[model samples]
Target: MSLGASDHRAIQPDNDDIESRIEAETLARMHKQLEDRRSFLQRTTSRRSSVCIYRVPPSLTEVSANTIAPEIVSIGPYHRDRDTVLKFENYKWSFLDYVLSFTRRNGNDLDKIIRSMSDLERSADATLISSADFVEMMILDSCFILGYMYLYTSQEDEPTFSIPIVTRDLLKLENQTPFFILEMMYDLMKTINGDSLELLALKFFNLKLPRRDEEILKSTYTPPYSDQSIQCVTLLQRSGIKIRRVKANSFREINFKKATLQIPSIAINDYTTTLFINCIALERCTPHIRTHFSAYIAFMSCLINSTRDVTLLGQDGIITSFSQDDQDILFLVGIQTVIVILKHIA
Candidate 1:
């Protein structure tokens, strides 16, 4: 209270020094943050130099690794040698032989098929495997898948190894052999009797147009494919709209116009969660490509919130759940969970 002018002058320098230090530190922190943001934007915006077949992020798999990961069979490089998946290796080899034999019967050379796949491996950026390894993987995986599809689709009654679970495993995001590989194999062996890869795939997965909506889909199936932005099926049906199943080759083909929503038929079962999550994962990894699967899932998830929402879709034959429980549909769709996963990966 009795301080002199000299004492006040002495304290002023210390206060000024403290303020200067605080300002310097704050500026440095802000500069660091700005640099960090710039680096992140650069990384995200740049095109990927190589194709990637990614492992499911731990944040996503932690909740249900079983849901995203392959169980009965493994495809691509991600889970090819895991003990759980390797047990099917013998079966894969057997199927490969069958596919090779079938190709030979169709007047296609087995050696030529291998050479074609080897050529593809050189051009494809999807995997980092050596050329020899890539060719081998492509041949083995592609043959196995085609052979399985053939057996399943054929009318002849053979020893049946075809199961619903296998179809689910084949559709898993991590479990896919590249589509190009399958297409090549199909071209090699296709005859008038043999189906294209797309048609075979539809058959193997059992995607069918519901009889009720077939006429409407055929009528509205024209150019200018419009996307239905409505999220939920119940909302569409409530607005006096009809959900018609279409003969689309891919799940990405969903369109809406006037009073009709045209979608490819999908059968939801125990494997639905795995199938959808994997498809969404593929869309997430490939940024340049159309987010067809992700958009479809988002639209479906928006339609599904609770059991009542699921029930409404079921009533219209828009959605058919394996279990009649609405909670199962909620858990399978995992709208909030997927949104978090997508954001995290983004």
Candidate 2:
């Protein structure tokens, strides 16, 4: 079951990390980067997602009066406090934000959105993400991955999964839900107008409701709904799947199919700056071609990780809102990758 470093990596046939000496300074830099990963940019960036965190004070009704739950919930780091939300003028508050003044007047619109679909009596037909929400389509890839197993199975092609939801029972919205699910879901649903098969896979691979107030922070850039597939692979290894490493040549086609390709770093274009200039076109000619696409992903990841576009924020007496173009590039790559993945599926 061990999908050791060997099985996961393509360029290397064996333990790649174990191959060379650990260059100390580079490793140290990585650790430092992890530590400094949090940014003031986050503070300035406005985000509203379904995920958030909370901590419940042990009921103050006398510390030992008798505990009903008897355990501190690992649910939140809670996002839904009235005081936490700031109400803007004319009811234009952050939609994903559930905090602030809790009067019926301020939150009535949200209540309406949640209730409108509950009318779908059975969870079977309920639209989880609102029909009208605008969100990124790449997330559908993850949902497709989640539902893939069921689709391949003999389930009569009917959706048969249930994701946890808190309801307008915002009062009962607790602090903990299994995390990764909500994180990706929030990211995936950021634009729901998405009609990709990747998005529809959301029907399976559903989750137990997350505790209220816990926001899903996507630490890694995975195609949407990929969590279940990755998790399943991991668990399989744990259960003795014995994943083995093979060269990029082994998966030549699929690699290219999902890749933003680069020719090997040979001397091609003699420009003052290096762009992935020697771009050769790739077209999917056969089913076997998909295997090779992974190599392209590896190259793309390197290009993505190594290059960064650091921008000076707006013309604030000082600069502001600067974002790494790499991030935007990654999103673009994801959207494109999903289009290719779905071509075969569709």
Per-model CA lDDT versus the true structure:
0.68, 0.28
Q: Looking at model 2, which ten-residue stretch has the lowest summed lDDT?
A: 272-281
- Clash pairs (backbone) in predicted model 1: 232-303
**Per-residue accuracy of model 2 over 1-346 as CA lDDT, tens digit each:** 6677756766564554554445666788888886666554464332212222222222211221111111221122233222322221112222233211221333444354344323322222213334322121112222322223233322544335311121111112232332343334333333323333333222222222111222222121223222222222234335554322222211121222222221222111111001111111121222233322333433333223222311111111111222434243343234234434545564
Candidate number achieving the greatest lDDT relative to the actual structure? 1
The global Cα lDDT (0 to 1) of model 1 is: 0.68
lDDT of 1 by residue, 205-224 (tens): 55322333233222332232
TM-score of 2: 0.16
Cα deviation at 302, candidate 2, in Å, is 2.5
Model 1 Cα displacement at 25 (Å)? 51
List ranges where model 1 is wrong by over 4 Å: 1-64, 124-131, 156-159, 207-267, 287-296, 299-319, 322-325, 340-346
Candidate 1 has what TM-score? 0.61
lDDT at 300 for candidate 2? 37
Question: Which 10 consecutive positions of candidate 1 have the poorest summed lDDT?
Answer: 216-225
